[model samples]
Structure formats: C-alpha cells, structure tokens
Target: MKLDVNALGTFYRMAREGAGLAAGRLTHMTEVETQVGVTKLNFMRGREIRRDFEDATEKVAVRVKLTGAIEGYSMVVFERENALRVVETLLADSDSETDIDVDAGEFDEMTQSAVTEVGHIMNSGFIDGWADVLETVIDVSTPEFVEGVTAEPFFGEVDETPDEDDLALLFQSSIETVGTEIGFSHYLFPKRESMAALLDRLRTSGGIEYDKLDGFDRMAERGAEEVAKTATTLTGIDTSVEIRRLNFVSLEAIPEQVADETLVGVAFEFDGMPSGYLLFLFDEESAHEIVDAMVPMEVDEDGFGEMGTSAIKELGNIMASGFLDGWANVLDTTIDHSTPEFIHDMGAAAVDPVIIQLGENQEFAFVFDTVVMADGREFDCEVYAIPDENDLERALNNLDVDRIEETPTTAEFQELENS
Candidate 1:
C-alpha cells in the first residue's frame, strides 16, 4: 500500500523514536514535513518502492535528503556526530558529545552495512506476516488510508523465527557500531591464544604472587570443567572438552567499588560447544577495573564510570549457551533458553537457587554454595546427589529410563558382596 504524507511522517516518527530509545537518548523531533518537488518512484519489478525526503535548511542551505525504500532507508544526518547525536538528543536531553568523532568515511561504510543488514531482514518475506498489525496501527493513527499494499511479516517466520544466533549477530553489530563511534576496536570473541599469552605474561611479570599460582590453576581447572560439562550437555556429545585456561592479572590497576579490592574472572567455553561463552566474575572492585580497562581514558578518567552493560550482557549470553548445553545433555532432552539475564553486585549472601517441579505438585530445590580454601588446606571437591523421590521418578519417566542401563535389584549387590 502507498504511504501518504501523514502516514510516512508517522512511520519516520515511530522509527526515530525507537532508534532514539536504542541510542539511549531523548530527542524532540519536529514532525516530518514533505519537501516541495520530491518524487515517489516504482521500480525493481514491482517488488521495490522508494520515497525521497529533501530539504534546504537555512543554517547550511544544503539540500539534505533521505531515501527510504521497501527494503531499507538512508539519510544524510546533517553532520556525522549529528547522526548519533540526533538519536542521543532525542533519547536524552544531555548535551554530552560522544568521546570520539564519527568519521564521515567510516559512518558511510557502517551505515551502508547496517542498512543492507536491516534490508535483508525485511525483504526475507517473514515480516509480511506482521503487515496486517502494522496496517491496523497505521489506519487507527493516521487519517490517510493505505491502498494496494500487501503487508510484510515481522522479519522472521514461524519455523525460521529469529533465534539466539540472529539476536547475537544484531547485538554484535550494534556493539561494533557503538565501539567504532567511540574509537574502540571491537572484538566479540577474543582469541584463546591471545588470552593464554596474556596469562603467561602476567605470571612471568610478577604481577601475581608465585604461591597464588596454584590457586589460580585450580580456579582455572574448575572453570574449564564447568564450561566443558555445560558444552557437552548442550551439544549431546560425550567427547572430552577443553577450555582456555584462566589467568590472574594485576588488580592494582583495576577499579575498586565501596573501597574493596576486586578480582577478575576470565575464561572461555571451548572444544565442545559450537559457540563458546566468556565468563567474567568480579567483586565490585574487579567489575569497575574491567570497565576501566575497556573504556577509553578520555571517557572515563578515574575508571569508575558506568560499566559496559552491553558488553557484560554479551558475555553472559555466551556463557548461558554453554551452561544450557551442559544441562540439556544431563537431562537428555532439548529445552529452549531465553536470553541470558545479567545480575551485578551479587554479594556473598546472594543465593543461587535451582527449583525443579514435576507433574502437578512435586518439587525439589538446590542451592549453590561457593567455598573458599585456606592457603595450607587442600580440599577435595565433592558432588552430592539429593534427589526427591517423586521428582526423580517423574524425571526418569520423561527420560524413558527403560532405555538406560540400570543395576539389578538389591539382591544383586548383596550377592556380589557375598561373592
């Protein structure tokens, strides 16, 4: 259907509003006004439609224009900073400029990439299913009636709905754009070798004590095991798993929170899972320290500013996959996972609880406890199985326990002992 002037304005307004929210800004956008002499064109074998917005502003008197088509849209956002600044301004009333300038050349490249990516998502015909709702909203809000229009779906189909992988790609793209705008090199998956090399350097550089090396090794081993188990379970594989070893770097340069020292946890899920997780655990100080390490000095002079929530969220996302993989394998059934939710400042008293419910009323619970070892003490790790009889039976039924190997009756154990 053709979008009239008012409808087009509404579309722009809605899109810009959403973009403003995504950009973390508050802006007051003037209602989109049609420029004189602008033309609408039909092309691309009845599959594509295009509209242009042009304006000669008094400030620069430049003929700034924006073109939107069926697949995607592009605009020359006055100045490079104005592109981001516009969104920021719309979202937030703050006048703070971005730490790094958006280079015109880079902006063009990234914009083109984003536009193309969004276009492919829209043109996939999956979005057509959502067209009716979109049309309904448009009809209710605007006086202009849409005509000859076939609505598109909502970017993904029932069977081919956008999953975690698609969301991850979009998240990566958004982060890269933000990082590039701030002059930071984006690395979603840091190389394992590089992390290992950094660990080696930290060990030799005397940044960490020689005696603490064993503790670090133990921690790394535990982390690797956790990640490996998770990966195997998720992938339904019985293969051995290997994880990138963890290392302790100097914490002196790290930021402190509430005047307490922080420790950083870094490990990667490798070998078993297709996409691995990067785990970061920190005391308040360590959390700030990592943020300090990541953010440019220009943006955060004291390394005590806001932590990169998006980056941390991505880290959690990766780790969630590994953990889910492990749990699914243990259960021998596939379970869908929602996007990982992040929690910060999780104190010592914080309890991680696992609650399992079966049938109508049977339930069981497990609480995770973290143990700290003394310098001179060696403690063997223990695994305790405390299964609820009813819940266990239910789970056994779900797994079709008949297929799994089972021991003979208690008589067999007594016979073996007697023998």
Candidate 2:
C-alpha cells in the first residue's frame, strides 16, 4: 500500500497552518501569547490508537461531532495540569480569582464555557483548513467538555471498546504561552473506508509537491554530516553518511518497504519538542565488520557476539545523539533520547514495535533514511527518523517554509477584537 507522499505532506502542512490559526484565536481570546502548533497527525487503526488515552488514566477533553460533507467527531484532549493552566490563562484578566490549583480538575461554569469556546475555535481552525484544501465545507457541532481517561463520551455508547478494524485520523496540537504549555491530541473517527474518498478529494484538489519536507532534508543532511564526523572520531574508521530516502510515510507502508530482509537495527527514542524514533539499520555482515573495526581486538565467532552488540550499540548511541544534537541546534529546542535498543531480526519485525508504539498516537511516520559508509565501503545501513507528528509540526513551523497563509483578514481581526 504505497500512499501518495505528497498529499500526506500537504495534509501535514494544512494541519500545521490550521493549528497556527487556532493558536492565533486562542491568543486573541486569552490575550496571552498563545502559540498553537500541530504535534502529531496520523491515520491509525482505531483500537491501537485508543491505547494512548487508555494509558492516560485521567484527563480533560472537549469534544464535538462533525456533520455535513464530512461525518465524524473532533476532540481536543489535554493533560489534567495543562487543562487547569488553560482555565487559569483564559480567566486571568477577569474579576475572578486567577489561581488554579493543580489538583483542582473541576472548573466553574464560566471557566468551562471559556475552555469550550477555545475548543470550538480550534475545531473550526482545523476543519476550515481541511475544507480549503479539499475545497469543501464541513459543519461542526457545539463543543462539549468531558473529564475521563477512558474517553467514554468521545467514543459514544458501547458496552466495551470495539476492537473492529476502523481507521482514525488523529491530530494533536500544543497550545503554548510564556511559562505555560499544554498539548492536546485531536482524533477524527470517520465511517469505514472514508479515507479513500478523502485522499481522492485531496489529490484531485491539486498535485502536492512530494518534497515539502525539504526542510527536514536539510536538517537531516546537516545532522548526518555531524554523525559521520562523530563516528569517524569514535570508531577511527573513515565514515560518511549518504542520505538515501527522506519522506513522510504511513504505518501500513513501513513493513512493505522493509520486506523480509534481515538486519541489525539499533533503535533510539528521541523525546523533545517533536519526539520520534531513530533507527540505525545495518546488514549482519556490516554490523560484524563495524564491530570488528570499533574493537581493537576481535577473535570471536563471525556473527555478532555479546561484545559485538555492545560495541554497535555504543556506536549507534553516539551517532544518533550527535545527529539529534544537530537537529536541536537547528531547531533551537531541547531533545533527549532513550538508550539504544539493539535487535537482530527481519526488517519488518525490526520496525514493527516502533510502528505499533508510535501508532498509539499517530498514523504517519517521517522516515529519514541514510546509508552509513565506512572507509569508502558501503555499509548497507540506514538511519530512520520517525518523529512525532505534533513535534514535527512544531519543528516545521519553527523552520522557514512556504506555509499556507495564516494571517487573519481585516474583518476577522476585527471580530477577534470584539470577541
């Protein structure tokens, strides 16, 4: 199932720009420097996606049903603390008390109304962007606030969570102000097989340029250079990085691309403004050769022994860290990574866990594949950058790109002032 990478990128851009609008509206209403940015967007299986909210245990969400051309539901879910912060910020200038205790999950009538209004504006921002791109109008129902971790109201009446195979388009956005930041993931559950029509609408609307992620290409290129230099220094093996493929892809497409080939994959989880996974994949032979080069003395079996795995893990950690350090420098944000996990398995299986884990929050994954060469010999290895959608949106917003027009019209600005 090879999806159109261009339309997906356009959709990503649309969501990002839409979030920018939503953030502007929030700032207008709160009179705070609110920054709204898309953090994640993906089309994932319904049951797998629910794991995110289920693990949440408890949270606050504002939900609304969509009607007209598109039939589905839209929601803005916030962490308990951030929801409280939102309430405090919205009511700051009012005569009411401006303090919000972290433990206070319940909001007063005025506060609830204010939050619901924010949700309405955000929902409009997102749908309006979709309408403009697809050239269609979609109406939204009134926003309703609910507090629960199971997401009972959002899913409607069901004796138990349905595990049927249904697609969910999940979009997450983060609302940030000075000294206050909160993230909310929005999910849209349309009828089964609705995506084919949606994608067709997007494609027929226009041919989207597939390389819009050129921003990330530049970022990854710079980061790869850094990783190559660091690897050369650490392993004392002449090394270089050749970026092979860079594009946005969906979860289902990953296994197809990787196929049944076996490889040694070192995985790292990066957590930051836009969190994602970085995988260093190498052929078994290359893994062994690289391990041999890293270790001064190697006389064990040909395959990757305990010592070989540890050496490769260290090399991967160093290279991955160096690479993300470059990204952090370019994006001007902090990014922390998890310990590298080493796996020697089939290519599809190597990435399955990552896809499933990320699937909990998103449907698409950004893949930045690069080949690491040693001493002019092709290592037959790849590096993948599977970043969170919301974080990628934020990171992309930080970069200068040909984004959709985000400024409000004169009448709209006037309306904002009055509101």
Candidate 3:
C-alpha cells in the first residue's frame, strides 16, 4: 500500500480526537474535571516491545478484539494502583450493598468486572471517533482481563500475525484530572494489512498544506526519539522523550526559550532539500552527568574544559548524525551536515547565528521543542531542530510515507503451508 504524510496526519487527528472523547467520558462518569494531554505515536516491531514498558512495574490491562472499521485489538492499560483507584470510583457510584475492597492488593471477581467497564468506556470512545471519521461501524468483542508485570498478556495472542520489523502504532494518552488523580494509556494493536489499508483511506481524504505541517510534526517527533535512544546507548542510562512539541513562531520569539545562565551545547548546519541548523542544549548539571557517564573519569575542570568539551562534542556528533539520518529516511534523500560547532557560552548565543541567517527572508520558523530526560534527573537534554520552511515543503511533496516499510517474515508462508 502507498501512504503519504497526509494519511499519517489524519491518523494523528484520529488519535487526538479519540483521546478527547475518552477524557470527556471519564469526566462525565466520575464527575471530575478531566482534560486531554499529550498524544503521539511510536512505531515499533512485533518481537520487540521493550519501549512499551521500560521497567517491570505491575500493569493491569483490559483487551478486546476489534473488527468492522479496523481489525486487531484495543487495550486500555493502567498501573496497578491506577486500576485500584478506578475501581474506587465505580464502587462509589454504585449503590449496591456488595462488599469490595479497593486497596486489597489483589482483584476480586466484582472488582475485575468494574475495571472492565472502565476499559470498555475508553475503548468505545476511541472506536467511536474512528467510526465518525471513517463513516463506518466498529464492532468490539468481549472484554479480556489480564494482569502482569510483562507485556506477554498483550502479545501472547498474536505471535504469528506481526513480522519481526512490522511497524505497530502505539498511541499513549494522558487524561488530566482535577481533584482525583488517575493516569492510564490506551493501546491499539492492528494487523499490518488493516493498518496499511486504513492509512490509504486517510490519504485519499486530505490536502497538501496540512500534510506538510503534519509531516514536519512527525519529523520532529522521530528526531527527538532518536536522540533519546542514542543517549541510552552511549551512556548506559535509560532515557526517553519526556515532552515532544513543535511550534511556529517568529525569529525573535525563538530566543525567549533559552536560559540566561551559561549552557553547554552543540550546533550544526546541514545541506539538503529541507536543510537547516540543529542545536542541542544541556544544562550545566546535565552536561556534567553525560561526561561522567561517557568519560568515566574524575575531571576537575571548573568550566567546560578541554576533556569535557571533547566528550560533549563527540556525543553531539552522534546525535546530529542520527537526527539528520531520521529525516533523510523519511524524505528518502541524503542530508549532509557540517562539522559540529561546540558552544560553551550563554544559552541564547547558540541560536543567534541561525536566527540572523534565517531572519533575513523568513518571518516564522518551525521549532521542534523536545525534552529528552533520563531516570533520577541524571540526563535532561533539550533539542531544537529548525528546518527551512520552503525546503521542507518541497521535500515532503516528494515523500511517500509507506516507503519506510520492511519486508515481512514467514507469517504468510506458514499460513500458506497450513492451507
């Protein structure tokens, strides 16, 4: 199937709209003020789902098979405490005389039933949103309850369906509550062919300008994700993208986000169809942490001295290469970046050169505002990926989103042999 950025954008809208609906339902049910929070996609393969659960915190999820508009499974996952808290709400709303303990550390039959209802509400909201957009009906099967520390409950049912490199779209949503606090995420695991067909349908229904902006948003998301992955690999620390944001503002407003104190950073300029400058800034403490993790020596340098600078510069090189390589893969082209320009000055100084160069012809720029942080506040790095607006459009115009697919393994071969 041939897919483009437009389809991906449309699917993003579906995820956003679905999250709003789910939030509204929760607000209505519990009578608490609830709102939708960050929504983004993660593309991962079948056999590897380590990104879904970084550590083995106990998780409780309700899974239900989906058919009609889309096929596969729709799951609502909650932390163990979060699930118990949800049961608290349902029991409060019920006037029955049945005895139930919310904090029992284990689920009873009645408690299980109550949590399943909550999961069903969440699943229905997302399905309704997709049905409205696609103008079709989606039928959901019986709810299945599973509780464990691993992702096996979710994937055990589908070992043969997804190939090794098949891309699965995982959407994580945070519903902000006012008085009571309950945090959970919704996951959709669809068959590859069904997902491809769904994207093709969305592609047939959107426009050009919107597609370009959506394409840029996706580019920023993936670039930030790569930075986190690279940081983890180099530092032996587990890091993830904390906050991902993309905004369009004037050149002057870009510097307003920088700090007043001195910062350690790396800057680079790239040349390609959608070429621009990339700047990564780390706070003094974060820079020190990276040096400690990567260098593993006690360097008594007051400022970013020679040895400290070299360590940071090397990290910057790998980060820049990964960020541009991600963009190149999406656009199916090559983007060459210049030598890393080390920055050991004030925060705003790192962005001034790019601002002066681009401010000449353009009034606004798309700034990828991302925060990549590690556990225990050990690593907190900020990414600023600013690409040329005109060049980005031209490159996206020639982009095919489905070009990123990898060949499937032997799932189909097994099916044929059985037949």
Model 2 clash number? 8
Q: Which ten residues in a row have the lowest lDDT in candidate 2?
A: 410-419
Q: How many clashing pairs in candidate 3?
A: 0
lDDT of 2 by residue, 1-419 (tens): 11244557667767776787787777777777878866445545565456656775567777777766567676777766677777776656543564545465467676667667777888888877776766778888778888777745556542223244465666756777777666777767765435556656545223322223445545666677778888788777787667643445567666656636788979999999778888888888788777877788855755777888898899899988888987776666778999999998898888888889888977767776666677665465677778876677667666544431221111100000000
The runs of at least 3 residues in candidate 2 whose Cα sits more than 4 Å from the true structure, single-residue gaps closed, are 1-3, 94-101, 158-163, 204-365, 368-419
Which portions of model 1 miss their true places by more than 4 Å? 1-281, 285-307, 346-364, 368-393, 400-419
lDDT of candidate 3 over 146-183, digit per residue (tens) = 88887666667753345545545556565555456466
User: Over the stretch 304-369, how does candidate 1's per-residue lDDT look in tens digits?
Assistant: 333455444444355445444443454354434445434453321111121111112322211111
Q: Which residue segments of model 3 deviate by more than 4 Å?
A: 50-55, 89-102, 157-163, 179-182, 204-269, 273-277, 287-334, 338-379, 383-419
lDDT score, residue 24, model 1?
29
What lDDT does candidate 3 reach at residue 277? 89
Model 1, TM vs. native: 0.23
Native-vs-model 2 lDDT?
0.68
Clashes of each: 25, 8, 0
Worst 10-residue lDDT window, candidate 1: 410-419
